[model samples]
Target: MIAETVTAFNERWWNNFLESTNVLKKTNVFHNCMQKQETASMREDVMKIIRLIAINNIPEFGFRLYIEGKNIASKELSSFFENFTPGNDEKFEEWSERAFGDKKFGIIINRGEKFNPTLVEKIAKKITPLTEKVGIPRLGVTFTIFIGNYGWTPLGIHTDGLGENVMHFHLGKGGKTMYTWDVETYEKIVEPANRFNNTKIEEILDKANVFDFEDGDIYFMPYGEYHVGKSDELSIGLTLWFNNHTESALAKKLIDSLLFNNLEESYEILPMDTSPYYDFENFEDVKKLFHNNFGDKNFLTLLESTYRDYKMALYSNAGFWEPPFPKAEKIDHNLNFKIKIKEPFKIIYYSDSDSLLNLFIRGKKISLINNSSIIDLIKKLNSGEQLQKETVFNTLDISWNLDIKKYVLDIFFENHIIIVDYA
Candidate 1:
């Protein structure tokens, strides 16, 4: 029998859930998954995000607002933010109601991890254990925030992209209901062209597997399930998407990454008589081009190396598809400060060779000389211990130039791998 609900979510629970053969094949709800304090913290972070939207701090592409199921135009949104001034004590729902007047509206923010570091940290703490057990997917994970009082999902009944499953965390002053239909069942009832039809929801409502959840609850739905959400009252939720790409998709992404990293543009035009058709001799030229770009490495070797870098970076960023924005302010290396690795994230490193080490910090890679001192220092940081800036520098090899040590520290500071507390 399918286990439809769990009392809580944690590493042990996740492991047990996965052990079930029907794990991803069914919809599951986790009740009281988040503690009251944790839910309150999440609500606070979401409010800050809403305020960021009001001040235009969030990028245009990061968020979308819909009124009565119609997407608001960018210019209109800009105008709305320009005139939106909330009182210090004003709640988000209150502002949302005032902004839209009587019309029902929904707001969705993509890449929410970039906007709130605290939320990301909290989520990572809960999720890292699962990842540690099963490993992260090649394509990584991303999160979206849904906030609204809209009666139905603005997108209508839809399935996410291929190989994408979602875990929704409900943090609500209200409640939400979700309806899902398996692919085979949905296809049998809905016409091909009208599969996404929101207007016809009544016709299929009784056929769906219904789930209603309130604050501190979580709902998990597998990939390829046709689903829609209903929130008749003000509510907010965060959904994390775990993207498990098909082999072909993974190959395409790796090739794209390789090309992006190695391909250099040349302004020179090819000879007029150059043949476009491939011959054995031309194939040699192709091989030479690969060699020139990749230093005599075979194509497979190049792909393997690229995949390693991608995976390490993804893992280092705590499976976030997009890492958090870099630290905004410049670091003053000369001043004394306490530094430590950011919570729930650590520097990932592997030795490429006896002489070189590959380090990934928040999805950015940096290469360094493979020295014992440097490795030891990284280990200490990863241990979650705070260290003095001067002490960190002193821990490095004395033979190394002062400038090199400072540059290394600067990279860590800028990439947000290390949090600095000014003394």
Candidate 2:
């Protein structure tokens, strides 16, 4: 089962979550599976060390590393980060001995799934479905692990970028303690837009509220909050960075209008005014002239014709030209099974008349055929209605059309949409 935040973030909680600066949860998403990975990948483990140095122009009050309950001074980070030797086991042993053995703390910056080893990859797969269920965009989390016998954040107070975060003390014998200040107090201590002012730390230490997340505790930090933490004992933390995905419909509309336009059925280049007055410097000008003079008047009318003659089906991989699925050996539908759409997929369509229509599934257009006959079929499949075997025989009324089946199979291989036995 997936874990829940303290407030159970429904639509009603959006106002409070957004309006408030920082709210603390009662516990972290405590789990036992990630412990083995605590010492797993060294390269992934030490990824963020250099980013914490003061010379990086990063302000003192930013997401940074800490020792066992204390912050590492900026000047000391240089000598500390020199231990790792890229790709040499001998150098690594020498480095780890000096870095972990001498300095005693390690820094890792988990940017994304790019470095996902066995453990982090599994955690990502688990959380993806839960996010989808809650309408959250599936841009998975970043896993930054802190490894040390003693841990305290030397990064000082900081606010992460715009997104929610899950700080899980997934493995450790010690406990995690966090202190957060409301936005107002943080802004007063460090200028909202400027953190280089050498602000006194005493200002922030005064107004903060403290909380703790022991083993298995999961704390959800909503966006735009200032916080810092400390931990005792050998500990490993997996920080899951999450945020809503926002896409502007207008941008898509504009691109579609431009890429897909009305064109004349017959193409004949019009005579151009070669008087040098038509000279242009931009690509947009050439595009306008080309479309106006040689483009079709009803380009959409050619859509079906293009499909009929096309050798391969077009599967949308969001502009990725990956190979289309192999064609089925044969098309036969005398089966006795009812049909249903696959889980995690949705079929959507828009039609002027049954004969001319556009069908989309999982953000990809599946416009292989243009006919009113299949409209009923599309509706029934989307509605989760089970069809009788007779419908499959008919292939139009209670049945799904063969062409639809073929195209769906191509995409089903991609898992964009699927066909399944009726539940």
Task: Highest lDDT: give the candidate number.
Answer: 1
- Clashes in candidate 2: how many? 19
User: What lDDT score goes with residue 341 in model 1?
Assistant: 93
User: Against the true structure, what is each candidate's TM-score?
Assistant: 0.85, 0.43
**Could you give me the TM-score of model 2 versus the true structure?**
0.43
Off by over 4 Å in 2: 1-156, 162-178, 191-206, 214-218, 229-345, 352-360, 363-366, 371-404, 419-423
What's the lDDT for all of these models?
0.82, 0.46
Candidate 1, residue 184: Cα displacement in angstroms equals 3.1
Name the lDDT of candidate 2.
0.46
Off by over 4 Å in 1: 1-9, 15-21, 47-62, 85-91, 265-291, 330-336, 351-356, 400-404
Backbone clash count, each prediction separately: 0, 19
Give lDDT tens digits, candidate 1, residues 1-423.
Answer: 996655354666787666642656668887778877778678778877777677864447578889888888888877777776454567766777778777888989988887776688788878887788767877988889998888888888998888887889998878999998888999999889988745578788989999999989888888888999999988899999888979999999999999777766455554444665653455443344443749778789999999999989998989987776776677787678988998789899999689898899888888888888888889999999999988898989989898888878888888878888999
What are the per-residue Cα lDDT tens digits for candidate 2 across 31-74? 33333344234223333232222234332433344554355665
